[model samples]
Target: MSCLVSSTCSLVPFDSSLNRPSRSSKLGSSISWQSSFPRLSIEIGPVISSPIVKKESFVQAAWTRRSRGEAAKRPNKKSWKQRTDMYMRPFLLNVFFSRKFIHAKVMHRPTSKVISVATTNARDIRTNIPSLVDDEACRLIGKLIAERSKEADVYAVSYEPRKGERIEGKLGIVIDTIKEHGIIFVP
Candidate 1:
């Protein structure tokens, strides 16, 4: 018994510019452009490519591009320290104790009473007194000192003026004794 299966096959030519290699059949016949191209002989397998294109993914790509463009347009910002130092470098010389006194003098308050000086770990209100001093006062003092002399560095020590009050008489006696020791008050 003999069996013959007749089938109609369509052949498509592969473009060489697309880098597709040509194949030949076993029998040397007229080189048909259809047969010259290799068959993609994929086995019965799962469909890998999805027919539906994702529209949301395109939106994400567009957003990414927009953000990149916006970033390129904006100037870089200075860090906190950089900005602060830019404004502070000039006045840094006047931040000393003697300078502070001179600044007080220029402000017509040379004998500015040491209004409850204190030290604290907190950046603001470094005085011993718990009464909250505002930022304006601190800034004003700093500005005054900066405007005056740039000598004598002032550091805050934990000054317990209230405790010192208990020994005010003793302190006065000490001052008197020092004065007698030729401590001339050159005012």
Candidate 2:
């Protein structure tokens, strides 16, 4: 309950008179020892002890530091997801729209395997589709990918668009087409 309000404590300096020389001098030194150090009159009592916190082991210190750090910076999506089952993210539906073509991939997240893929540049799609990067092409690619996803035994999937990507235009059409084909999107 106390702050740092302590008194200064200094030990008495050594004196030659306190040393034992001869047997007769030793006897005289004990009687004169009382007067030898005048500064020894300073009152001595139990110290209040250190006001510092108790010591912590290395692991305890690390845990304390980690807890403080966690409060300062919250867990990001990746760290938050790690707390759940690793296999909880079964499949991921990622669509990439390039200048020349549109590519859709369904990946098995746990095993890092590609389950199904559909692209506008494929032989079947390229020959049938007039424009590879148009809304109709995106829809066809989405439907193809959905059918392929069903063949892979994945009924539901998750998708995260690129950073700062707005869900509209051709991109929106593709997503809608996939959902229209009965491939559920796990948000």
Candidate 3:
């Protein structure tokens, strides 16, 4: 019989045969307690040690098998939002000190352009307003917009030029507007 003290400690009935000193007649005091009782010296053989297997009670094993069977019966993939919410909702709630929620809005203008807005707060407006017409700013803003779109599902709509309209000129104007007002309407 054995009594487990904790996960790392256990007490087992000392085996008399193994505990018997090889040379009992030798009365040398140099030998330590380990040498006196060799059976008490644990010989952990090459065995795979797993916490699940170590502490698994009968009830736990039964419940685990039942859960596994139920999971096998219905296997489904989770959406990006659902997965994100499941992992990050608690963290976001703790950070924001409120319940977390996501709202998405897809707006279609009279022109062919389409604008999308997504945020937890309705008042938060993120416009892809270009800070500068320079190549560096354009690249940085492009990357930022792409990242924001993926995170919040907000797509910035760009206008399609008509026949004979200078695309570069319109782009310059848009950049100027963004630099001045920090936002510009699609089309």
Candidate 4:
């Protein structure tokens, strides 16, 4: 028997007598302990003479049948968001939070050009801000970035939050500030 506790147990052939209690010593006073379980027999087959053959997996078969054009398509992770969204959404809003600063920027996706950038590290912002990493700093950066993007004629943009990361707290404050500053966020 293959078990977690131990593998020392060996299968024994079934015993018909162990199926029921002995009728001759059934009285309560005359009792002898006996196992009631029927032992099961295990059969082991001879080892295969031929070497084991490797079967083609479903994924392998599908890959083999795939067209050359399909094979040439993007295979990296988040290809849809990175490639498709680049063209679909012309303007991209990206925000980065650092230990001591908040950086927000807008990019023109088609041209791969950085359109507007606002950061707490800038001389003007750095000199005025009391705390560079707080919500107020994020809001200031967000508002400045949004206004700059508008000056570049980009009113609608898209922000893709990191996968599995919540858009709340400081990040949320930045985004909300941008919207309040008249920047439209595309779904």
Candidate 5:
């Protein structure tokens, strides 16, 4: 019979009859030496060894996947924010576009607070811009947000497009306008 110490331990065989204790032969002792525990023998197995390597960060993994033509494997909005929060700057500039209006906000991620905001529905923008929603309106909103962000001391911003929105066309114009107004866009 054998006893297990750990999962990877090897089995060891022993002759049970030779190690059994006698009941009659006893010295004048208060406590008995014989006990119920079974005697066991162990044979150590060979040591196992394996190589270890450091794992890549989420952002690096994402870039690698992109380079491999696996665009669909990119992280979603929630995970992207969580990963970026670890290493990138704490300030984030978020832009949202809708059917009738475009909205932009500069947010401090660490404190979860908005630094500045601008939208087509604002009083000054509505009064100055003729159309509420269009390429021109998008540019105006971008410029307004950049100016306001500067007032709040935020010079750099990250653009987070929605699920399938491409960074071109009207969206491209908005981003260019923000950059022209002296705000940096984090890639």
Candidate 6:
């Protein structure tokens, strides 16, 4: 099966010296001449161009310029830690990972009191996990935090991951282990 489509296009001639639309002197119409370009005809699958054109408005141009100027004057945004501290929560869990160590802390957010801690630096964690920096070590830390938080009767926590780091790799392993051990993360 086949289909055919054809479209007519109008072209406005430009006066060389003036550089604007030149009226038709011969036909006495808006179109100055029959454009040498052929009418667009297409078959089946090819794309076709449209005749409608867009013109820029003075109001739109002015509005864009004003918006750009305002954007340039906007102040810097506050850090995530600053924002979280301002809007205090009931409980929060902060996990920090360094090159050779991983640390996890559960806190009473409103009063900023440290409730529980799990770190590779701790003797217990060091004894259980051979390495302090790997994913397995992070999972062990998560399990330790889960156990301590349960004893403290803290069930849920707002997980505060390190700034500029995604919740993947070692961080992901820690979070999964915590959930597996019956602790819920509050995003």
Model 4 worst lDDT window (10 residues): 1-10
> 26-102, model 1: which lDDT tens digit per residue?
53566554443334312222444433333332443443233556667764755467676433332211112231221
Give the alpha-carbon lDDT of every model.
0.32, 0.72, 0.36, 0.74, 0.69, 0.71
Off by over 4 Å in 4: 1-83
Superposition error at 87 for model 6 (Å): 6.9
- Write down the TM-score of every candidate: 0.14, 0.58, 0.20, 0.58, 0.53, 0.52
Worst 10 residues of 3 by lDDT: 89-98
Clashing residue pairs in candidate 4, if any? Answer: none
Model 1's alpha-carbon lDDT is 0.32
Cα lDDT for residue 170, candidate 5: 76
Model 3, total clashes: 0
lDDT of 3 at 142: 33
Report RMSD (Å) for each prediction in the order shown.
25.1, 17.6, 19.3, 19.7, 15.0, 15.9
Model 5 clash number: 0
Better of 1 and 4 by lDDT: 4
lDDT of 1 at 76: 78
* Model 1: ten consecutive residues of lowest lDDT: 99-108
Ranking by TM-score: 2, 4, 5, 6, 3, 1
Which pairs of residues clash in candidate 6, taking residues 3 or more apart in a chain or in different chains? Answer: none
What is model 3's C-alpha RMSD?
Answer: 19.3
The TM-score obtained by model 2 is 0.58
Q: Model 2, stretches more than 4 Å misplaced?
A: 1-65, 69-78, 82-86
Candidate 5 local lDDT, 62-123, one digit each (tens): 32233424445554534566766635877777777788888888888878899988889888
Task: Judging by lDDT, tell me the better candidate of 5 and 6.
Answer: 6
Model 5: lDDT equals 0.69
Instruction: Count clashing pairs, candidate 1.
Output: 4
